[model samples]
Target: MSTYQYWQVKFEHPDEDEEELKAVIQGLFNYYEAEYGVRRLTSQVRDYYRLIGKQAPNHKRVQRLMHEMGLKCTKYNRRVRKYDSSKGPNGKKGKNKLNRRFMSDRKYQKMVCDITELKAGNGKKVYLEIIKDLATKQVLTWAIGQHTVFCK
Candidate 1:
């Protein structure tokens, strides 16, 4: 099994009634399993206890206990991350002129465009390209169709 990242919630419960804590934990897991059909429900369970005036449990303990209870996030229906950088043609990489700054002096000094794909009613992916001006925050151009050919 793959290990989880440590974006986990941690706590030190002073009111450590063992049976009470176990019951609350069971309810949290049960609710999430019924609603989402997924075991990656840590955040939701933490939020539930927070709403009920109870301290959240240590993430390590919760994860260990959940695993003992046979709860795990399944990855059967997950799609693979697939992308090819060397497809078709070459593109120019511009200089790091702005250096991560979000502000500029002159209008249209720099422009950026991004494309998003949406699944249509007929199950076909439709691409939308949006070009924007930096200084004025205006949309310069846009096109809607089906193509992966991103260019300047």
Candidate 2:
């Protein structure tokens, strides 16, 4: 026989207690599948027994049962990293010509360039490069293409 079958036959508990615990664990697992992890599920199980006035099982026991039954809360909150402006592998750290001065005496003296992504209705990826004249607040030139080489 397989190891699982062997273990099941060798160390079987009384039918009443085993079935009741299994049913309660399954119910709680289904109820909290979206939000609760093992820790919260353990507390919920304890709360359940407290309401029914029965002896609550240990949290580690609940965690073990959850592992055996393949019950898990897959969604976890994650923090996104902050965006950095000067991060790349171009090997050229060119000086900022504008020196953070947005205002310009002449029309094209201090121009700003930016590349933005565009999502079309057909789901194709397109990139748009825009050059703006800082003094007049007008677009000097704009180009759209599938490749980012337009910016380079």
Candidate 3:
């Protein structure tokens, strides 16, 4: 037989076992809501085979299958944009007296203050205001509350 004919016969037929394994992987991927990456998926697949009394496929094989099937975990892949304070009009810009020199010989010589927003366990937004000393790398003061704006 010609080399072309032999190649066609060898490569044309898909493995039945591989098809079933791909189906299993797809089912697991959906069951976890696409949060399982290759490592976790491989572990789950191994457990599944153990439950069924069959030998589990190699992790590399599972990875290759996942790549071919275009499966990916979405949890860590999400991009969250941070809040930018310099974008809108508000107050006069503070002079850069520090001139980017963050280091200081004394604790209170170079201090910085910032406000951060955090989410509570009940899904409510909490704002935290903190003052820190750059020399000692310690927090001087901190306050937490629900409102970002304060009125006198």
Candidate 4:
């Protein structure tokens, strides 16, 4: 066939129906809340095709389509380290006066304190310290500050 005839035939009969495939991918991606990456999406697409008794598309094709459609997983890739109070310079270790006996018959006789670090909605760090009565399980005192020095 001549070049013009080949071009006409190619245009008339495309190798793959990309629009239909893209629609299916978009539906599945939305159905999954955009958590499925290319690998899982490709597997889902294969399963869908198998269910319909049609040939499954190649993984590379699925990946390319997802890239073109700007679909990406929302999950973070980095490991977020939790707050550790003992990571820095060592302070004089205090004796465990409670000795694992948290029960108390009288109020104010035994109390426990804890410090927690929190992130505000504006991305600012906030520290919260709480002192509680062991017997009543009530917060005796609580303080919130921008710095850890408030605990002192």
How far residue 23's Cα lies from its native spot in candidate 4, in Å, is 1.8
Clash pairs, model 4 backbone: none
What is the clash tally of candidate 3? 0
Whole-model lDDT values for every prediction:
0.62, 0.74, 0.84, 0.84
lDDT of 4 by residue, 46-126 (tens): 999999998899999999989989998875544554545434446555667889999999999998878798989995678
The residue-by-residue lDDT of candidate 1 on 65-95, one tens digit each, is 6655666544344565333332334544556
Q: TM-scores, in order shown?
A: 0.38, 0.52, 0.53, 0.55
Candidate 3 C-alpha error for residue 100, in Å: 21
Candidate 4 stretches with Cα past 4 Å from truth are 1-15, 77-81, 85-111, 115-129, 133-137, 143-152
Kindly list the per-residue Cα lDDT of model 3 for residues 1-152, writing each as its tens digit: 69999789767987888899999999999999999999999999999999999999999999999999999998767675453333334544656778989989886888787778788999567878777899999988888888755211
Best by TM-score: 4
Of 1 and 2, the candidate ahead on lDDT is: 2
Query: How many pairs collide in each candidate, listed in order?
Result: 0, 0, 0, 0
Candidates sorted by TM-score, best first: 4, 3, 2, 1
The residue pairs in collision within model 3 are none
TM-score of 4: 0.55
